[model samples]
Target chain A: LAKTTQPISMDSYEGQEVNITCSHNNIATNDYITWYQQFPSQGPRFIIQGYKTKVTNEVASLFIPADRKSSTLSLPRVSLSDTAVYYCLLNAGNNRKLIWGLGTSLAVNP
Target chain B: EAGVAQSPRYKIIEKRQSVAFWCNPISGHATLYWYQQILGQGPKLLIQFQNNGVVDDSQLPKDRFSAERLKGVDSTLKIQPAKLEDSAVYLCASSPGTSGSPDTQYFGPGTRLTVL
Candidate 1:
């Protein structure tokens, strides 16, 4: 498994674009970048995933640079409901055991 | 589709007591996982099972924590003589067996446990 580094907290106003970046310098050849959002009392929900370049879904967009050392999650026109802890996950072999770290806490203020 | 389900939504016990939590994975999901999430931290995988057999339990504290999945349907996680640090949310998740990566897991609402 690869080690990841992300900011501890971020703040944004309503209707603004927010981008959360995660650095994974040790990403493996087959590792995939995935993001999950966790509310205060709920389990995590999938946001977006990508292997390279950019991948977009209805919920969010994931952008992985060509180097694959880092990735960014872009949320457009955020609202208070989008406030949550965002986790970046990678399955760098290791029998699919995910390395979950303390994620970035995003607070979307009204 | 129905998501993973966990019982007892909440549990409160004193130190050195025992507690148990149950989980029912999504129908037809062959892989089930148990996770512990401390306040302000991400979830830690405790155990993973493929059907009724254990797949990975390296992180499980065998001395006090035990989990079982019978008949490949539902599962139970037990903590004996619990400690104060055991107070956290217990989460259950399931993923399609054929998904291969097991990276995209569907999580339950989670069972909150507070040990005094």
Candidate 2:
């Protein structure tokens, strides 16, 4: 499993775009970057996933550079409901055990 | 479509007591997973099951923890002689297929266990 590091927390206001970056410098070539959102007392929900370059869904977008050492999860037009802990996982494809980091808590303010 | 379902939303038992958690996955899902989440921490994988077979359980404490996915539909995680460290939320998740499919896992509300 590839280890990931992200900021401890972030704060943003409604209608603003929030970007959280994760670093996995030793990421393997076969690794895939996936992001999940977790609310208090609820299970984590999938946001977006990507192997490289960029991937976008109805909910969020994932950006990966050529080096693939890091990735960023971009959320558009955030709202108070978007406040939650976000996790970035690496090598989710091959590793049965999806090692999760502490995650970056995003607090969307009014 | 119905999502994953878990039973006994909460449980409180004394140390050395045994407890069990149940889960029902969505129809047609082939992969099931059990995770333990400690407070303020990300969930840790306890076991992974493909159909009725075990795919991965390296993180599971076989001596005290056991899980089974019967008929590949429902699963049960049991902890015998539970310890204080066993107090945590047991989450059940299921995906459409294998991890290679990039299948998003649907999770249940989880069973919160409190061992005193």
| Top DockQ prediction, candidate number | 2
Candidate 1 lDDT, B28-81, residue by residue in tens: 988899999999889999999988989899999999999999999899999998
For the candidates in turn, chain A alone yields TM-scores of 0.95, 0.95
Candidate maximizing TM-score:
1
* Every candidate's lDDT: 0.91, 0.90
B1-116 in candidate 2: lDDT tens per residue? 99899999999999999999999999999989999999989999999898899989999999999999889889999999899999999999998876555667788999999999
Q: DockQ for all models, in order?
A: 0.57, 0.64
Clashing pairs in 2: none
**Per-residue lDDT for A15-99 in model 1, tens only?**
9999999999999888988899999989999888888999999989999999999999999999999999999988642336788
Instruction: Give the C-alpha miss distance for residue A68 in model 1, angstroms.
Output: 0.4
